[model samples]
Target: MTWLVTGGAGYIGSHVVRAFEDVGLDVVVIDDLSSGHREFVPGAVPFVHGDLLDTGLVEGTIREHGVTGVVHVAGFKYAGVSVSRPLHTYEQNVTATVSLLRAMAANDVDKLVFSSSAAVYGTPRTDLVTEDSPVAPESPYGESKLVGEWLLRDMQRAAGLQYTALRYFNVVGSGTPELCDTSPHNLFPLVISALVEGRTPTINGDDYDTPDGTCVRDYVHVSDLAVSHVAAARRLAAGEPLAPVYNLGSGTGLSVREIMDAMVRGTGIDFQPEVRARRPGDPDRIVASGGLAAQDLDWAMRHTVDQMVRSAWEARRASRD
Candidate 1:
């Protein structure tokens, strides 16, 4: 049984592709290379450079590869950018998903593992959010993801498609030296870039009601999240019922200041960060329970914040070198 991984050349997608291969699964990639790197796709897997919105190309790829399942990871992910470009976000995240599902149904490829986000649960009133948490997305990126999940649910009910939507917190760390995250919107890389250039990493929102008055977030290793994709895919293939949603994370929270301190510790670099006003749509604190994932999917994150920072710093350093 072969799999078609959308956005398979991107940061987390490439890592999931590698994880799939590690477990002996046949893999093929379809990426537009807009935010992904061509060099990230391993030579063993065949890649199709195209958009998921192109139904004909997507359908053809599924049929050509004999793809029995898909891991949908292609979408706009920048929170602030999505706000300014909501139309583009909707086009890439929601509209593309609808088209991709239709193409999958047409091709008889029904199984899927979706890459969702914690942004779906806006500013959580409670620190630890479960799968049952209220679905209130604050940003265009979050709303688009929620809409994607809704699309899958409706499609599954009507078209017999089975899917698992893994709502990720902040996905940090690199897959390998070759697969480092290059997103300017991502906080870790942005901080790393600042340190590399001898500039202070800026910290926004110093008065959030958290322990340290900075925004707290759950950070999960990209590799661990990728492993969950592999596990979920295999379980779906083995006839497990479609458990539509699960939160993926370390089940702990780290503040922005703490993360910066860890980065400084990891790199032995020091510069007092500039304080800035809270950005719009920025939440005070967000952490995942991930109990459902642990119970149903047997997933648990093994990487610590220190590990996450060290690995991320290592990847960023190697990329700069």
Candidate 2:
């Protein structure tokens, strides 16, 4: 009854690991420690430091632990980087997933919960996207995830593998007081770092066609997202029929300027942000319906924008303490 959490040492993965452990489940973590920290895994859980692309290692770990399911969270996630490093992104996200699939097949690990992203939607023709929305990924990162879902669907059709791919939108905030996102790619931490370091948080574009003239995204707290994964895993273990996809996000949208306002108010810091041009592949606005996750997983985001800000601020403060 153990679950293997790939990239469990990462910001989001660590949170999911904590959530699973809190529910009294046996958890084993496999991380390459490339971007993830080894210290993030709880001392109580067994941690394996390795690459998921290694079929032998992946199968061996699953077989050794009697793992029944895997939460595939490892890979390159930065949308901007994925554009520049398309080959590397493909190798990490797509190739690695294929290798993982092979390993799961060999080990008889029939269930998986994949961490997909809203980037798969690209610049939507509309503001709100549903699970059935047309996937026009602008960058390689999104393409890789969409491809992963495709692979999972095919594999499920051929094999008996059951899976649920959760397409996340703007995962922000901290789950616990100890685990804050240290990644430089995310908008929340990037802004917080800039402000904390006495520099301006750079705004990508000021002239977007949305309110506040900046990009708008749905921000889901990390804890709520983690809880959704837990629920998805439990439901799959209960022999629930697999739908193969769900969007884990809040239906509400928040503009970049609105997030900045929340960060300032939550941290009691008033700092001006530098206006800049738009990044190459950024969508003007990407909000989700999240109706599928709400109905299927029975999950809802409880934390507001202010709560996200406060949690990140507290984690940052704790880091410095």
Task: Give the range of the ten consecutive residues with the poorest summed lDDT in model 2.
Answer: 241-250
| Deviating ranges (above 4 Å) for candidate 1 | none
TM per candidate comes to 0.97, 0.97
* Model 1 alpha-carbon miss at residue 2, Å: 0.6
Clash count in backbone of candidate 2? 0
> Against the unseen true structure, what C-alpha lDDT does each candidate score?
0.88, 0.89
Write down the TM-score for model 1.
0.97
Q: List model 2 lDDT by residue over 198-232, tens digit each.
A: 88888889888887898888899999999989889
Candidate 2 overall lDDT versus native: 0.89
- Please give the range of 10 consecutive residues that has the lowest summed lDDT in model 1: 296-305
Tell how far residue 120 is off in model 2, in angstroms: 1.4
For candidate 1, write residues 182-276 as lDDT tens digits.
89888899998899888889999799988889998888889988888999999999988756899885678789999988887888897778999
What is the lDDT for 182 in model 1? Answer: 89
lDDT of 1: 0.88
